[model samples]
Structure formats: structure tokens, C-alpha cells
Target: MNENNGITLSIQKKKINDDDDDDDLTGCFKRLKKRKNRKVKKKEEEEDEEEESRRDIDNLV
Candidate 1:
């Protein structure tokens, strides 16, 4: 009975560690996704400005 209890306790501790690791991984991914979104937005805005400039040049011509 004592051995069984010890094994169960170890399993619980392992599960706790696994959970913590999962949480950290999720947080890291969230940060990466947020940064990627910001980069995409900035690129889109730059493209828009480039298009506007091209249109203005065409009008001038």
C-alpha cells in the first residue's frame, strides 16, 4: 500500500510539471503569433502606401 501511494504521488508531481510546461509553451506561442500579426499588418500598410504613391505618379503623368 505504501509503495502504491508513493507511485501515485510521483505521478501527480510529474503531471504538475507537464502542465506547467504546457502553459509556458502556450504563452510563448501566443507571443509569437501576436508579433507575426503585427508584422503582417505593417507590411500591408506599407503596400497600401506604395500603391497610393504609384497611383499619384500615374495621375501626374
Candidate 2:
């Protein structure tokens, strides 16, 4: 019985360690996704500004 309990405890500890590693991986992915979103938004804003400037020039001409 005692040997069985020790084996069970070790298994539980291994499961906990695996869960922590999964959490870390998800966190890293979240940060990378956020950085990608920021870059996309910046690019869109730049494109809009360029389009507006072109319109202004057309009106002046």
C-alpha cells in the first residue's frame, strides 16, 4: 500500500509540471499574437494616411 501511494504522488507531481509548461506556452503565443495585431493596425493606419494625402493633392490640382 505504501509503495502504491508513492507512485501515485509522483504521477500527480508530473501532471502538475506538465500543466505549468502548457500555461507558459499559451502565454508566449498570446504575446506574439498581440504584437502581430499591433503591426497590422499600424500598417493600415499608414495606408489610410497615404490615401488621404493623395486625395488632397488631386483636389489642389
Candidate 3:
């Protein structure tokens, strides 16, 4: 029937919208993860540089 077809189309549209929202959320999470990883990597690099400086000082002394 036409009524049933209309209902089915509405449901399909809603499902598509929901899928888009999920994709947006997934993208946000991915960006946050990348930012966190970059911060961690930068901190590690800074620590390594500090360690090297200490070693140089120790050698000089």
C-alpha cells in the first residue's frame, strides 16, 4: 500500500540521518585521539632532550 511505502521511506531516511550522526561522532573521536597522541609524543621528545642535556653536563663536570 502507499501508506506502508511512505512509512518505510520515513524510516529509511531516519536511519540514514542516524548513520551520519555516528560518522560525525567517529570523526570527532579520531581527531581527539590524534591530538592526545601528538601531545604525548611531544612530551616524550622533551624528556629525551632533557636527559641528553643532563648527560652532557655530567660529562663536562
Best by TM-score: 3
Which ranking of candidates, highest TM-score first? 3, 2, 1
TM-score of each predicted structure versus truth: 0.75, 0.81, 0.86
Per-model CA lDDT versus the true structure: 1.00, 1.00, 1.00
Residue 20 lDDT (model 2): 99
Q: Looking at model 1, which ten-residue stretch has the lowest summed lDDT?
A: 22-31
Residue-by-residue lDDT tens digits, candidate 1, 1-61: 9999999999999999999999999999999999999999999999999999999999999
Q: Give the TM-score of candidate 2.
A: 0.81
Model 3 misses residue 43 by how many Å? 0.3
Residue by residue across 1-61, what tens digits does model 3's lDDT show? 9999999999999999999999999999999999999999999999999999999999999
Worst 10 residues of 3 by lDDT: 1-10
Please estimate how well model 2 matches the true structure, expressed as its whole-model Cα lDDT: 1.00
Residue-level error in angstroms, candidate 1, position 61: 1.7
